[model samples]
Target: MTGANKQRVDVAIVGGGMAGASLALMLAHFCPHLSVALLEQRALPDADASVRLPSFDTRATAIAAGSLQLFSELGLWNQLRDYCAPIERIQVSDRGRPCGMSMRAAQQPRASFAGMLGAVVENAALGPVLHRALAQTQTQVLAPARVNRVRMVADGAQLDWSAGAGCPDTQLQAGLLVVADGADSPLCRGLGIVTERIEYRQRALVTTLGVQRDHRGTAYERFTDAGPMALLPLPRRDGSHRMALVWTCSEEDAAILRELPEHEFIARLQKRFGWRAGRIERAGRVSDYPLSLSLAREQWRRNLVLLGNCAHFLHPVAGQGFNLTLRDCYGLARALAGADLAQNSTVGLELLEAYGRDRRLDQQLTIGFSDRIPPLFASPGLFARGLRQAGLLALALTPPLRAGFVGQAAGFGL
Candidate 1:
């Protein structure tokens, strides 16, 4: 690439999905003087259009209370609230067993926002809101820009990218390069970052359900012999009561579930999930994703850092994957702010190392919580079942233990 096509920035973020967009917004808020560029391989949705990225699909994300606070600080809660359904309570239960626990936001005010434990928002609405906010910031947003090559240079890293097939490639020299290109990241592979993956051999079947009764701002976590299922509240549309469903099961079961007719699927789901959310009236299109625990060997190096699923892809049992990533983004932005990147190298090794150290505990706790919870609940053995019941009983009976679980689930103590 010619010098004319080359540019320099303090930080160049690859992948403009939720992770990258949120990080860009955070940097703009926390380190306003630093130059930042966000690059996405796909074309960004129009201002009035729907987002088509994989991250912003038919699925829904359960934003923890702490994450909501971060977005509110960014001045996004107003717009976000319009698309969100507040989660005032959470109901956890086993399919056949009576022992279970329920958590209410009122009981744990420290881990709540405006009387809400958290809120759920459809990814379609969330993407548009985030991108719309990014338009008001100083960060440069580049879509249809594919980075074909990356090389670690003395200053930091160099990226060669193109707008499309006919366009000439442009070179960008960044003091810090952040990879947020999702799991099994090709960019990470090219950079020699290896990911340790543990496949559960299960798939999460996701869909939206229309219920005959109101969800009443309750999120349900039901454990069954198949696996764990989560039914999170969603904003009602056109006088209909709706909820988002995430049902995890073995691969063989998933294949059978995916091919079943809507009515048959609802019947099976109702039978497996029971009457916790009331009668299921209608169902939307179903999608399934293979489950796994994927952790990148390195989250940060000299002048480079990894973000989002590219860094650590966890099981979605606890709805912690995106929230954890949000925390990571915020932490990195705060570190950059304290370092005053405008006056020094943006990709200083010492600064990056400090940031990683600060984030280690939160990452470990959240990853472990997501990794170990499903199997313990899914086990069929008598001892395992007894243990599950005992744990829930403790949480229900002990205020301190329940509060601790609520705090962690709400994304606080970071």
Candidate 2:
């Protein structure tokens, strides 16, 4: 490639999944004057077509009320609401125990949106909506473009990428580089960003289920000896009631469950989950992912920042991972909204540092919340069981405790 082929932008984002796409949109909205480019290894879906990326698989994400407000700001709520099932209530329980707690949106109006605590949307549906919105923005979209190398430059960072094998590489220079590639990021590894990881030794089995009756806009969190399970309401399709399920269990148990016949699997699920959501009539394909708490040692450098799963990968038990990332994206976009990146090199560094400091408390609390819940409820010992019961009792009986829990879960005041 000749020097004339090299391109420069104010910011370049790697990875066009939910995190990258969202940060791109936010930058366009908040920092319209800044030139931005988004690069993705996978080809982006057409405006009217379905998305087929790793992030847009059969899994579903629970968008908290705060996140819904952020989407509304981006003018995506109208398109998203059509495909989402509102979560009007949340029920938390412990298996084989009679004590449990439930939270209703009516009880905490501040933690809800249009009387909804949150909403669940399948990632497949979410991806196209996001990409379609991106098509209208000024940010450059470079899909099927693989980044082979990245290095720090005097100005910022430079990325060498190609369309495919034997294709000439193109160099992209930017004032700031946002890395949103998924966990175990190659770019981060090349940048020498160390990650702290804690494997839970459990896998989350995910699938869509056909339920016998309506879920009534309720999401259930059930904790058992095996692990934690979540049943989130989903929009009805073809007149069939459906819900998304995330069941966490040991590797051995997951292996058995994956191989079980449909009837046997449903039977075991029904027995374990109880009659809360009524009978499970059917299930779609099941997929499993290993659970872990992964945090990057450095989220920001002089000319770089980490976003999404690359920055922090939290357990999904509290449904907080994506929401936290959304918050981080918003914070970073706001910090860089009107900065003069070209005229002042130190401006970017100062803003990135401030963003990191502002996000520290929220990230710590949310990560700790997601990490502690599974083991606390999964414990079989007498003391742990007693603590679980007491916790449930406090949440059920105390309004302050309930409100605090609802606010945190709903992504409010942070």
Candidate 3:
């Protein structure tokens, strides 16, 4: 082991996936004077678009318009514009049921979900753009390296990383450290931050499919006894129009769904999904994951703050995880600009406190929103089902309730 380098930076961020990378770029581009060091375990990918990404595993993200505006400000929107699809409207309902509610851009809209509220982008495709944006900025990226230990003290935060073989260990001391390592963050646990996780007994089978008819830029959310299924708009890739499908079902049933033949799987999906768009065809392979909500005991602690999944992992029914974390980055950046990172280093106690305070309302609301929707539509009991059905009918006919729903989707009126 080498001696401690004792290097220092204004902000040291661990976990360079979407959240950490975006934060580094935001800070460097918007607050250049602040020295930012981003630690990403994966090797920095080549920016050449001609390079082929792995097939049968293209994950799509529904990006809100506010997130797009952030990307646009970083000059990334134009780079990503060609590969993405806009969601001009979103249809929320219980799959195949005649009575339901819908929301469209023209009915009530905002700039955050793209022109409507959000745009869906392939995750693999977007990663490179964020990397490119970082490469062009002043941020110092320590790729293929990760923190082995995080020591939070009264004075400041100490980060120790074991570099790749043939490289060396690193010790970075910063006033503030952001943890975007993900929901199961080792750093958070190491810091004695207990996270509460609630298993929904559901799993989501995620994949893309070719629609029999045009999506017309509308995203669909339908709930069945199994769980809530969403078909989000996707750009035409590999010579076919695509939409990302997130199908939630009981853990055991999800396993059954995963083993079914492609044709059989699509047939069952069509039965519940109905033929709203026409004949549905599988566009890619499916990937399944457990669904849960994980919330940290606190968002900030002694010069360290958790962002993205590390802070809160939502059910994805509302498509709020990434967007909510981006807003955290937005809020923290503003807090730093308005206050002092230097003085707050020891605890950043004041800044962190404020960030925590401003973030709580949004966090609780989004988490609850995503958590409640699935159960509301999935319950089968006579009373529970009736209540949900009645609510849907009232929401469909009532203007105020419909407008409120739209406002919430637009990232406001919460």
Candidate of highest TM-score = 1
Each prediction's whole-model lDDT (CA) = 0.91, 0.90, 0.79
Give the per-residue lDDT digits (tens) of candidate 3, residues 1-414.
345576877788999999998888778766776888899877888655543444346888888766777788778888888768888877777754667877676666543444566788888888888888788887888888868888875666888886777566788888788999987988888888899999998898999888777788888888887788889988876677678889888888888888889899999888878776568977468889999989898888767888889889999896888988887897888777777445324445777888788978877777888888788788778787878778888888997888776665555554
Candidate 1 local accuracy as lDDT?
0.91
What order do candidates take by lDDT, descending?
1, 2, 3
> What are the per-residue Cα lDDT tens digits for candidate 2 across 258-365?
888888989999999999999999987788989999999999998899999999999998699999999999999998875555522433577888889989999999
Candidate 2, residue 263: the lDDT equals 89
| Best-performing candidate as measured by lDDT | 1
* Ten residues in sequence with the least summed lDDT for candidate 1: 49-58
Off by over 4 Å in 3: 1-4, 48-56, 111-114, 342-347
Tell me each candidate's TM-score.
0.97, 0.96, 0.93
Q: Ten-residue segment with the worst summed lDDT in candidate 2?
A: 50-59
Better of 1 and 3 by lDDT: 1
Deviation from native of the Cα of residue 143 in model 3, angstroms: 0.5
Clashes of each: 0, 0, 8
Residue 163's C-alpha lDDT in candidate 3?
72
